[model samples]
Structures are given as C-alpha cells and as structure tokens.
Target: MFSKSCNYAIKATIFIAQQSLQENKVSFVDIAKEIDSPTAFTAKILQILVKAGIIESVKGVNGGFYIPKRKIKKTFLVQIVDAIDGDSVFQGCGLGLSHCSEKHPCPVHDKFKSIRNQLAYMLKTTNLEELALGIKSGETFLKTL
Candidate 1:
C-alpha cells in the first residue's frame, strides 16, 4: 500500500531511532545495507526524511544520522508517510479513480473507506519508539527471517 521509498524510509527511521536510543548515529551506507535498499535510493529517502525533520544529520568525522530520543515516542507513522508519500494515501480513492468521492462512489468505495480509516487510525496512533523497541528486543523482524 506504500511506495518502495516509503517502506525504506520507515525502516531507516526505526533503525535510526533504535540507535538514537543507544546514543549512537548511523551512516547512510549502513542504513541502506540494513534495510536491504540500494544506497542511492536510500540516500534520496533519507534526504526527504531529514528535510521533514524526522531525523537529523551531522557532518563531523564521527557524525551521522539519528533521531532525538524524546522525539521518537511522539513520531507517528502518519508523519513519515506524509513526509515521503504525502497525505494522498489517506485521502485518495480506493480503486484509483480520480472522481471517486462520496457523491460519485467507486464500486469498492465504502469498503475501502473503512479500511483506509483503520489504516489512518493505526498510523496516527503508532509511534516509532515501540517499533524500534520491538527490533531492539528481537521481538520483531524488519525484514524476512
């Protein structure tokens, strides 16, 4: 349901959040390798993330990318989606019709509305901290095991 770049962005953010929790930073190269994305594509995604203030970048010899520890708890999935994919996923038609609104509903409009609402709710309520912790504790896998 998300773009490929958005998927990598979420993974990169969670990884960065985990490192931030440990008072560490990650280089873009490491982020790409860990998330199984190409370095160039991950670079573009990370640039968007940094521009959106979801992560920070530094340029010293020891510097890299990291999120503020306190901010991760408040960084909801919606924000990341918005930053990378915009709010269209939350507001677009189910069947990809440009005119699929309430007045001119698509065949699956009603059903998809419910699913979209559920997705929106999940994104709004879910924060990066819990996701980062899940990986940190070995309770979840960001990639296939």
Candidate 2:
C-alpha cells in the first residue's frame, strides 16, 4: 500500500517513538535492524524525517535519533507518509491511469476512492503515540520476530 521507503519510514518512526517513551535514543543501525530495512536506505530516510521535523538527530559520540516529547503525540502517521511519499498515495489513481477521475472513472475508481478515503482518514487520525503504545503492549510490532 506504500512505497518501500515510506514503509521503512513508518516502521522506523514507530520504533523510535516506542524507544522515546522509555527515554531512549536509537541509533541508525538499531532502527534499521528493528524495522528490517537496509541501513543505508534507513539512514537516508532518517535524513528525510529529520529535515521534515518528524524526528530529531543528535550529534555526538553517543548521539542517535529520537522523536521529541512535544512531537510524540502531535506527529500523525500521515505526516511521515507525506514526508516520504508525498501526497501521491492519496491523490493518485488506484488503476494507474494518468487521467482517472470522477469525470472519467476507471473500472474500480469508485471502490478505490472509498478505500482511499478510509486510508486517508486512518492516516490523519492515528498518531504515533497510539502506535507506539500498541508496540509496547505487544499488540503490534515492526517485524514478525
């Protein structure tokens, strides 16, 4: 449902949030490993998240990445999705038509639109805090293992 990079971003952010609740900073290697993503790609995604103000990076021998306390609840999943994948997921056609729209609908346009609306609603309403809590409680996870 999301690009590989966006998937990694969400996973990494949620993991970082889970760590932040315990007042811990996570290194790039740890984040990548926890999310099952490539280290170099995860580093690049972290750069994007930092630039977008969704996460913070500290510079020092013991420095690492963390989401700020102020942002823990304020940062919604949509923000991360937007920062990494832009608004394309919400705007583009499910059928991959260059000009698909209500005016000239694709075969699955209406159904796709309904599904997209639900996805957008979930993304906008679900904050990282809730997801982190789920992870902490063992109700959810970044990876199967």
Candidate 3:
C-alpha cells in the first residue's frame, strides 16, 4: 500500500497526463477536485512531483501543471512512489519491526518480501500514459463517483 499523499500524487499525475495528451494544462484546483484531495495537500504533493521531475509547473495566467506528452509513456508509477514514499515500501518489514531483516526475519518476512517484489514490478512496469488513457476512456477513475 501507499501513503495517502502518494495515492493523491498518482491520481494527480494521471489526470495531468490525460490533459497533456489533449494539449491542456491543469490547475491545482482542478486536479484536487478530480482526485478528491484537499487543496493544500494536493499542492504539497504537486511540489514533490515537480521536484522529482515527474511533472512540470508553469506560472502566470496561462500556466498550470502538466506532464510532457513524450514523458507520459516513459513515466513509470515507481517514480511517483519514489518521489512521495521513497524506496521504503520495497524494503520495509511487513510486520513493521524496527530490526527485521533476512537473518532476523519477521514472522512473514519471506512471504512479504515476495509480495513486495511483485508490487515493485507492477509499479515499475505501470506508466502514466496507460493509466491516463484508461481514465480518458472512462474505463477507470481516480476518485469515487
């Protein structure tokens, strides 16, 4: 699983990518509305994304947030996760133990490690373009309707 901020970041990125595909930039207000995230929190998440090179922002009247059309396909989900949550999810102990590791494994360490690997693969392979397209097609969504 991911932090609430990271989840919102992913939704916001996908929304931005969808708009980018249509050659439009999106305001943080619109992104927050689409993802059903609080404005201040969304702004924080956007800042992190921008700093991570996962999204871009512009200033002035015609300015807003957008992912480059070309980068959409190349922007994997893992990048957003890393930007917001870092690599903690990948190496973190399943049981939330402070000193859990291979030799001093948690009760579910082996199984949890496998699950983490699969999740990492999923994140690494999943890209914003595909997710955005799914939303644009109305087959998927970032928030409850």
Candidate 4:
C-alpha cells in the first residue's frame, strides 16, 4: 500500500496531466479539489514532485503547477514515489523484516517478488502523457464517484 503522500502525489500528477492538454498550468487549490486531497498536504507533495523534476512550478498571477515538456518524457511513477516516499516501498522486504534477501527470505518473499516486479515494471514504464491520455479516454479513472 502507498502512503498518504504517495497517494496525493499520484492524484496531483494525474490531475496536472489531465489539465495539461487544455491548460499549461493549474493552481494547487484546483488540484486539491480535483483530487479531493487536503490543500496543505497536497501543496507539500506538489513541492516534492517539483523538486524531483516530476512536475514544474511557476510563481505569478498566471503561474502554477505544470509538467515540464522535457520531464514528460523522462519522469515516471517510480521517480515520483522515490521523491515523496523514498525507495524503501519498492525495495524493502515484503514481510517487514530488518533485512531480507535470497539467503534470508521472508515468509511471503517468493509470492511478493513477482507482484513487486510487475509493479516496478509498470511504474518504470508509465509516464504522465500515457496516464493523461488514459484519463482523457476513460481508460483510467482518477476521481471516485
């Protein structure tokens, strides 16, 4: 499971992606509302994403958060997760051990390995444009009804 910050980051990223097609930028308040996330927490997450170069921010009357044209090609879900929550979620032991490895496997190590690999693949391969298109085409749903 992802942490609250990760969840918010994903939501904010998707919202920005969806809006990118229509607008070059969006306000933090707008993103928070669209994702139903807390404004303060979402702001912090957005800052982290910006710092990670997963998202871009500008300051001015018309300035706000937006995905950089260049980053749209290089950034992936894993980077965002790493920026906000660190790599432990993806690399840590599945059974919450202090240390886990092939020689010291956890109870669910084998079972979790396949699933974890698949998730890593998806995160590494998927980018904001692909996710944005999914949102626009209804292939993905961002908000809960």
Candidate 5:
C-alpha cells in the first residue's frame, strides 16, 4: 500500500490535472480543499512533485501549480510515488524481511511477487492525463471504504 504522502501526491496531481484543462494554474489552498488533503502537507508534496519535474509551479499573484498539457505522456504514477516516498514501496520485501530474495525467499515472497508485479505495472502504465480524463468523465470513482 502507498503512504499518506503518496496518496496525497496522487490526489493533488489528479486535482491539478483536472484544473489544467480549464484554469491556467491552481493555488495550493484550492488544491488541498479540492482533494480534501491537509494544506501544508499537500503543499510539501506539490513542491516535491514540482522539483521532480512531474508538475510545474510559478510565483506571483497568478502563480500556482499546473501540469503542462504537453508533458502529460511522460509523467507516471511511479514518478510521483518516488518523488514522495522513494522506491522503497516498490523495491522492498513485502514480508518486511531485509534479506528476502529469489534464492532466500521469505514466507510470503512468492505470493507477494505477483501482486507486486501487477502494482508496478499499474503504476508504470497509468498517467495523470488518463486519470484526469477519468475524473472529468466520471469514469473513476472516489469513495472511502
């Protein structure tokens, strides 16, 4: 599972992507409210995403964060996760064993392997634009279970 920061980053990214279609930019406060995230935490994640080149930002009266429609194809969920939580979520052992590997497999290594591979594939294949479109068209569902 992803961390809170990663979740916040994805939500904020999706919000920005939605806004990019109409608004030129969006303020941090507005993004936080839109995604129901903490203002300060979302701002930090946005800064990280901007620094990673996954999103853009400007400073002025009209300054805010926005994802350029041009670079949408190059941005992936993996990049956002890495920018916020590093590669540990994808690379580390699912069973929490420090030495788990092919030769010295953990108890749940084989079972987790398939799930991990699927997760990695999803992260690599999904982009902000697709998610944004899903949001706009109501193809994506946002609910808490």
Candidate 6:
C-alpha cells in the first residue's frame, strides 16, 4: 500500500508528534529505533519530511527533530504520503501498470478503485495528533517488537 520510505515517514512523524506533545525533541537514532528502520534510511526520510515542512530540524548540541505544535493537529496522513510517495498511491494502477485506466482497465481495476478511495479517505481524515496519542497511550504501536 505504501513504500518503505512512506511507512517510515508516517512512523517518524507520529513519534515526533508524540514527543512534540510532550515538549521534547527526538533524535534520528531514537526515531530509527522506534520505527524499526535503518538509521541512514530514516535520516533520508526525515530530510524529505523536514523539507516539506512536515517536521522541523534543529541544529545544536541539544538539537533534534520535532513537529511544530500548530502542525500536529493540522497535518493529515495524506500530506505525509504526498510528501514521501506523491499521488501515486491514489492514482497508480492496482497492478503496477504504467497505463491502466478505465479505457484500458487492469484485471482488478474497478475493485481496486473502491479500495483506493477508502484509503484516500482514511489518509485525508486521519491526522498526526490522533495517531500520536494512540502511541502515547500505548493503544497502538509503530513497530511490532
């Protein structure tokens, strides 16, 4: 459903949002560990998120990453997906074909459209704050272990 980078971006953003709610900053190492992603790969994803204004990067001895308080509630999962994976998740073919459309439909095109619409709705409606709270309260988790 999402690329590895997008998955990490969502996890990292949720983790950062939780820290932001606590008025704390999170290091790349902490984010990588929490998300169960490689540090280098997580750093690359964070760079994208920072550039997209999804998260902030502080540069100092005590610096780390955190989402602005204003953004935590306003930022949608769709925005993070757009920043990391573009509109491909919403627009791309169900079978990964370059040109599968209604005119030239794939085997599962119609069925997939419904699923894609549901996913889009979910992404558009789910914001970072709610997801962060789920993690903060231990009702959900970013990593299996």
Candidate 4 wrongly placed segments (more than 4 Å): none
Instruction: Give per-residue CA lDDT, model 1, range 1-24, as digits (tens).
Output: 999989999999999998899999
TM-score for each candidate, following the candidate numbering: 0.97, 0.97, 0.97, 0.91, 0.91, 0.95
- Give the alpha carbon lDDT tens digit for every residue of 53-92 in model 3: 9999999899999988999999999999999999989987
Candidate 2: which stretches are off by over 4 Å?
A: none
Q: lDDT of candidate 1 vs native?
A: 0.93
TM-score head-to-head 2 vs 4, winner: 2
**What C-alpha lDDT, on a 0 to 100 scale, does residue 124 get in candidate 4?**
91
As for model 3, its CA RMSD to the true structure in angstroms is: 0.8
The digit string of per-residue lDDT tens for model 6 on 1-145 reads 9998998899899999999999999999999999899999999999999999999989888899998898899999999999999998999799999999899999999999999999999999999999999988999988886
TM-score of 6: 0.95
What TM value does model 1 have?
0.97
Pairs clashing within candidate 5: none
Candidate 4: pairs in clash: none
* Model 1 alpha-carbon drift over 4 Å, by segment: none
Q: 30-125, model 5: which lDDT tens digit per residue?
A: 988877888998888888899899899999998999988877766889989888888887776887888999999988998898898998899999
RMSD of each: 0.9, 0.8, 0.8, 1.5, 1.8, 1.0
Q: Comparing candidate 4 with candidate 6, which one achieves the higher lDDT?
A: 6
In terms of TM-score, which candidate is strongest?
A: 2
Report lDDT (Cα) of residue 101, candidate 1.
89
lDDT of 4: 0.84
Could you tell me the lDDT of residue 65 within candidate 1? 97
